[model samples]
Target: MRHARDFAVTVLVLGLLGVVAGVLWSLLAPRPPYVMTGEGPFLADPSTQALIADDGWFAVVTGAIGLACGAVGYSLSRRGRPLAVVLGLAAGGLLASYLATLVGGAVNLAPASITASGKAVSVFPGPLALTAHGVMYAWPTLAVGLFFALEGIAGYRDSPLRTPFGGQDPYGPLSSYDISDR
Candidate 1:
């Protein structure tokens, strides 16, 4: 029961962090600098064009999320968790971030302008849409990668070495090696 409760807390914290990340991305994302000033229902306005042109920014935001995930994964690994637990946390964090992006999209308000003849009216409205591209998957992938990298680098000793007979330090390998020889 304790393990389950801990897991739930971890997931909850990760999700909240994901929402924060999403909000930050929405606030920081680049948007169209110009507004439409023509008549006849200009659907493909300059703002829309700018959005299309800046598709790379989405990936950038995802990469930032990935780095955050990696950091969290690394921290978890350092806690002596089993590999599966670490991986699970990474997956949870990614899912949370994805959900967060959707929330962010819904809450995002951007400046929009509609023009008729020589007059223009500007309004701040929710964003057109938020999308999750395949590139966004890199966030979780990178998290797993970083977790392993950190685990290897830190050389955390979660348990004593065991042999097929389940005896710790069965071979005395560490005793055989001289630290000065390295």
Candidate 2:
């Protein structure tokens, strides 16, 4: 029952964090500048770097959030089953990434193109969007990776083979050198 509760709480908290990630991505993601003309909107500068940067920002923010979630999840589930915790992290990370994309895109909705008067060019900010959809995987991937890494570290720390003096041997206390002499 306790494990179930922990899982539920983990999922819920991560879902909420996803919303926050979305807001953060919206704020941090760069807005590409577009020139609005009668024909359509075009990049103000020849470079599309800003558009790529926006995606990078989204990945960074969400990936950071995922790492936090992994650490937090591991800490919280120390007394519970790790498998349950990992599953929760995976599910939550996926949900969070999707939410971040949706909310960020919605929050940064592009304005309708304004008709430029005569030779005047109207500059507008483009909508926040993920040019590389694969970037979304960063969240879940980092989350799981972090969780496993921390788990391995903790396991290593508590391992019996990690003797303080390195004097103990796992094979019936007989060091390999001693056995070879016999």
Candidate 3:
């Protein structure tokens, strides 16, 4: 169990570093359609246009929820380590970002439909390489957050769910290092 705690702490620390690095990287090198890409704003089809508009709202709402999640994560993790606050917040951020992956799947979504200036277009959100971003970054973020949460709930402690976790000698293994002079 102590080993697990150590491992979890290491992961949380790495996750904190990741949050700092990711924010820096995002700021220093933002991707498109945010930046000036060769291909301008996607003149989406009608269906896609409507999808983007609706999904834009989804982004806003999800972002708000993500903020709330980060707050919750930070507050909860303070029970453990001060730095672990990062672990929880990072988790919420990753969880929110991952929802981007599920946005299409979680909801029965259709792309935005737009009929403007005689140009009917459909626009769906999520830029290219979104999957890569989620996999590479989100995984670590959620892992550390979950670890902190695990510690908070005492699930990492002794119980029937994890009898072998506490530091103790198993009856069979104790004979290996018995140094008594009985």
The regions of model 2 sitting more than 4 angstroms off are 109-118, 163-166, 169-182
- What TM-score should be assigned to candidate 2? 0.79
Ten-residue region with minimum lDDT total, candidate 3: 28-37
Candidate 1 lDDT by residue in tens digits, 1-182:
54465456656666776677667666766544443435523434544654653345555665666667667656754544545546556666677658656755666555667775777665344352444356446556666677677776666444334224466556587879888998
**Please, what are the lDDT tens digits per residue for candidate 3 over residues 1-182?**
54355336544544454444334333322122221225755533333344344334334434444444444545555465545455435554554344444433333323455555797644434242232232435344444545456556665464655655454655657556657865
TM-score of 1: 0.61
CA lDDT of each prediction against the hidden true structure: 0.59, 0.82, 0.44
Candidate 3 segments exceeding 4 Å error: 1-48, 109-182
Q: Could you tell which candidate, 1 or 3, scores higher by lDDT?
A: 1
Order of candidate numbers by lDDT, starting with the best: 2, 1, 3
- Per model, how many backbone clashes are there? 0, 0, 20
Query: Which one wins on lDDT?
Result: 2
How far is 96's C-alpha from truth in model 2 (Å)? Answer: 0.4
